[model samples]
Target: MSTWMVTGGAGYIGSHVVEAFRAQGIGVVVVDDLSSGHEAFVPADVPFVRTDVQDREAVAAALDEHRVQGVVHLAGFKYAGVSVTRPLHTYTQNVTGTVALLQAMADAGTTDIVFSSSAAVYGTPTVDLVTETTPTLPESPYGESKLVGEWLLRDQARALEGTSTPLRHTSLRYFNVVGSGHDHLYDTSPHNLFPLVLDALVQGRTPTVFGTDYPTPDGTCVRDYVHVADLATSHVAAARALEGGHDLAPVYNLGSGDGVSVRQIMSAVASVTGTPFTPQEAPRRPGDPARIVASGELAARDLDWQMRHTLEQMVESAWRARQAAEAATP
Candidate 1:
């Protein structure tokens, strides 16, 4: 089995990717700093390297020791709102870390990479349905850092053209990734909508829906929400595509063709958790887009991307995992 090094494999999304890869009989070695990831999230059998991705020597050593053939880069500061205040930290984690990882990959001669990018790169796009062709006008430093990571991959690939080992890479851009693939794994992002709402209910607080008077049909913001499992499978597919010598576009959007609104999500959560509570209405967050959904046609065609789970399924799985985590906590 070919080995792949997942940079943030202990993370919510990365852990799911690790699970998916292992399910396909692929070898996975995880390198995580545990900044926002729990060591328990990584399977006991997998080789776990507890170090920051920015540490070039450590990452390179992990790659060499594991005989890793490819890399799944997911480590970064992902909170967009907090990134506005902590721009330097976001850049260092996402941008500098990516550069270090790429350098390590070059040193190790491991070229294939699958990057975990975000829909934030579009930055409140005017287009109703965002495509890869949409301009990347990243608003927050976090988004900018992600875009820069993509640029680094592109430039590195170009620089390696015609080499014996050309860089092979593709970045997956996604919006509002939610749900859990395993009962043991759950989204822990304090800024994500699903986790925030789940946390509110777990803490006996009413979840707030900011600005419900959006121009959408339900008067709430409509955004793409793909299940974490579905997203993970696509990442594995991308890696396989690269390994198989298939040419892929530089970026692909893993999105729901048409998305669920915030109100619909709240309704699903209420139904799943068996707790019916009207969400508190709050003022519109400045710079919050009214609606931003993307077409997954590119990824669907190339990477087997699809919304395999319904909104209710996403909520149910997430609630179950959250409950499991709470039960296990002291």
Candidate 2:
């Protein structure tokens, strides 16, 4: 069996990607520093290396030792609002870490990779539906770092062109990824919407909506929310395509074409959790966009992308996993 290394395999999305790879009968090596990732998320059967991705020598050694054929890179500082205050930390983790990871891949002769990029690369796009061709003008340090990661992949591939082991890569620009692929692996980000609301509910507090006067249909900011499981499936597909020698676009947007309002999400959470409480509305935050959705046509064509779960299902899955995680916490 061919083995691949997952840089953030112990993280929420990265763990789900690891599960997807295992489901498909592929060998996986997990590497995570556990700064934001949980040590318990990695399976006992999979070989795991706990280290910072910026440690190129450590990562390269793991790859060489495991005979890794490819990599799925998802390790980074992911909070956008926090990134503003911690710009240096964000760049060091996302940008510099990616550079080191690429060097490690080169050292280990791992030619194929799937980069976990973000929709923030669009930086509040003016278009109704963002596509692969959308102009990238990142607004935050986190978004800028993700965009730089994609550029590194592209430039590295070009630099290795005609070489015996040229880099094969693609960046998956993900939108608001929510929900859970397994009962054991749930999103733990304190900054994300689902978790914030869920945590508030868990604490017997009402969840508050930051803004309620946006130009969206429901007067709330609209976003494209994709289920993490479905997103994970596409990562595996991307890895498969790269290794199969299929031509793919340099970047693909993993998103839902239809946008959902924050109010709608709150309603779904209420309905799914059977907790009826109106969300406290507040003034719009700075830089919040009215509507941000993307077209997944390109990903669908190449990566088998599709919206596999409904809004209610997304909320329900996330809530269940959150409860599971809470119960497991000692």
Tell me the TM-score of each prediction against the true structure.
0.97, 0.97
Tens-digit lDDT track of model 1 for 1-330:
799999899999999999999999999999999999989999999999999999999999989999998999999999887888899999999999999999999888897999999998998888889999999998889889999999999999999999987899999997989999899999998778999899999999999998878888988888999999999999999999999899999999998978789999999999988999999998876546778799999999999998999888999999999999999999
Give candidate 2's error at residue 127 in angstroms.
1.4
* Candidate 2 per-residue lDDT over residues 1-330, each given as its tens digit: 889899999999999999999999999999999999998999999999999999999999999999998999999999887888899999999999999999999998899999999888888888999999989988888899999999999999999999988999999998899999899999899888999999999999999998887777889989999999999999999999999999999999998999998999998999889899999987865445677799999999999999999998899899999999789879
Span of ten consecutive residues with least summed lDDT in model 1: 283-292
For candidate 1, the lDDT comes to 0.93
Model 2, C-alpha of 236: deviation from truth (Å): 0.5
Model 2 lDDT at residue 213: 77
Relative to the true structure, candidate 1 has a C-alpha RMSD (angstroms) of 1.2
| Position 263, candidate 2: lDDT | 90
Candidate 1: regions farther than 4 A off: none
